[model samples]
Target: MLDLRSVEIGYGIMDHARNQGYATETVGALIDWAFAFASVEQIHAECLVTNLPSISVLEKVGMRKTKEVDDRIKWILKRNSVNEA
Candidate 1:
């Protein structure tokens, strides 16, 4: 799920469909849509530290790692800091 000030988007794909780049594509597309239409200044995501694939997806979608607390890592994609593909 991605959360901004007052808007949030969430998704879940079955285990069998994991790790095929589907999450990355979905996240990227959503980010694009959000930045284009939403009033939020940044998008945020949280993932378990052990979830490498999820981490990759966040980075691929232009979210930078900002901080970590215990087993979770926090990521943020700012409107002005988006990395163009």
Candidate 2:
């Protein structure tokens, strides 16, 4: 079962719109919204190792590697950890 304190994030950009920062901006905005507007304590995301763009988005938004299950990497960001200096 999914944790009540956490939510999973996912996004897809069309082929024609790749690399224009939509995925990164949208994911970051959603993270901020979740932490600001709800009781969410953490957020999770998963992407394949070969998905460079998705990896970049996750990193840019301050997510950290949690684990690798099979061929996918699990990433996470906690509410207390957002915008840390």
Tens-place lDDT digits, model 2, residues 6-46: 89989889999998888988998999888885679999999
Deviation in Å, model 2, residue 28 alpha carbon: 0.8
What TM-score does each of the candidates earn?
Answer: 0.80, 0.93
Candidate 1 lDDT score at position 47: 89
Predict model 1's lDDT versus the native: 0.78
Tell me, by TM-score, which candidate is best. 2
Q: Which stretches of candidate 2 lie over 4 Å from their true place?
A: none
Task: Quote model 1's TM-score.
Answer: 0.80
TM-score of candidate 2 against the unseen true structure: 0.93
Give one digit per residue, the lDDT tens place, for model 1 in 27-71: 988888878865777877888999888888887878888899999
Q: In model 2, state the lDDT of residue 74.
A: 95
